[model samples]
Target: MTQLKTLFFAVTTAALAGCAATPRKYDDESSRALNLARAGGVYDQDLRDSPDGTRSYRKGLFTTLLDVASLATSFDAPLRHLSGTQTFMFNATDIMATPDNPSARPSLIGWMPGSLAANQDDAYEHYVTVVDEAITHAAESMSITATKLTDVKTPEIDEHPLMLWSVTSERYDCGKSNCIIAYNIQQPTYWKTPSYVTGREAASYNIAANHPEEYSRLIFRQSGDERTFPVGEFYSAVSADMPPWIVMYFPPNTVFQDGEPLTYPVLYEQGQQLMFKEPNHE
Candidate 1:
């Protein structure tokens, strides 16, 4: 059921974002794209049957973790040796959306997954632990990290508030010509952590949006870096070849420092919310 919802939102919003691909961008009252960018897995409520260490989750602190495992199972990644640090692993594959457009990227319907033991505490939760480790590994293995980020802030629109952080590190980059992608994954959702944002100002982070950029589509690193379809990497090479309607992840207004970029996690409070109640939201 949850996967179904994700699929609906994914394809629908992707279509909305894709509308801009035509001549003269189309700015409908649609917030579908923004909601789609909320970031999460296709398996969410459907992966309960996944093996010992695999699962799905909504785009949250822990959703990144689920992405690592789910994506690895369905897609291949350039980075290796990340599994050792992960808590679980998926043993399945062959579940991905391989669009037939050179400009599009592969997405997923369902995929295998992996998991790791989680720790429950006030100072930190299992999800935060997962994000921290991915960042650490991305830094060590990818040799990259965002340069400036004290708190979440919009990189594209300075006045948009610090809802997200951006990075310029190699690991975070898409390694493409003009495109780039960056994100960290958290562990699977096992009801072990809070369902929503839980920072000191948790009440401030429930903001949701649908439409994204005029020049770009705000792609969610949903499954984070775990899936075979890397976050900002290629759209699966499968026969379903097409450019991604949604682009990869990045902070709104990223900055470079000493030749590299920095990032901070996003905090979507009510004020940080986007316009999701648009007429085209459905």
Candidate 2:
């Protein structure tokens, strides 16, 4: 939905607290929660959708941390009733390491009937995911690999299983004007490389040098030098439940405004990973 539409929904929903005459006070807390709920829909979708979101994820848009209270206070709802690491934690039994076996190709965790029995007392001890051998392989594909360390630094979350991977020092140019792109990295967190580099920096001297507007990638590698993800050549191979789609590559350079292209640059690739985004709100 466009911003205007979302605003309309929020305003309408917010206004409903009024009875025939008096209205409930809108609180800052509730308004804040509503905003979070809205933002959560957008970011969470980035991780779960193919190029677009499934209906379950979409249906969740209107729901927030609280319903009546949010309206009473005009606060954005919390993303969940459960807060802290609990929301980030996934059942340990349901997750596993990638490359099921190094000797065999990796696949997501399989269905096991007895894994978590009802009323099982020991079920809540911990949550876990096997380390990313897939991303390890992906890193190797691009000739970037981490050194052996005593501890692996992973993004902490309510985790079933997590995988994070992206290219380092990579350069891609999207000429689209005021373009907003979506991308997903299986790993838990990403760090943009090339210390202090920004989207404008890439646009000024990197692959996008010829085009202008604004474009950027997130959690890019930290290397001072530029590298390409070679994502176009890589595939998940394992995520059976893969979203309907994933971002592939950004077109060389193109800019758009008002749903129209303003400037253009030729690209061998059509655009950065294809995205199924909601219509822009005016």
TM-scores vs. true structure, each candidate: 0.22, 0.24
Report the lDDT tens digits of candidate 2 across residue range 117-144: 2322222121111123433454465454
- For candidate 2, the per-residue lDDT at 12 reads 54
Provide the overall lDDT of each model, using Cα atoms, as 2-decimal numbers: 0.26, 0.22
User: Which 10-residue window in model 1 sums to the lowest lDDT?
Assistant: 105-114
Q: What local lDDT does model 2 show for residue 52?
A: 24
Write candidate 1's Cα lDDT for 1-282 as tens digits. Answer: 999999997897677534422222223432322223333221122111111111211224333222333443343342233342121111111111212221122121100011322232221233233333434444344444423233332333212211122334344343221122222211122231112222212111111112332121222232233222233222111101211221222221121223222121121222131222344323
**Error of model 1, residue 112, in angstroms:** 16
Instruction: Indicate the residue-level lDDT of 28 in model 2.
Output: 34
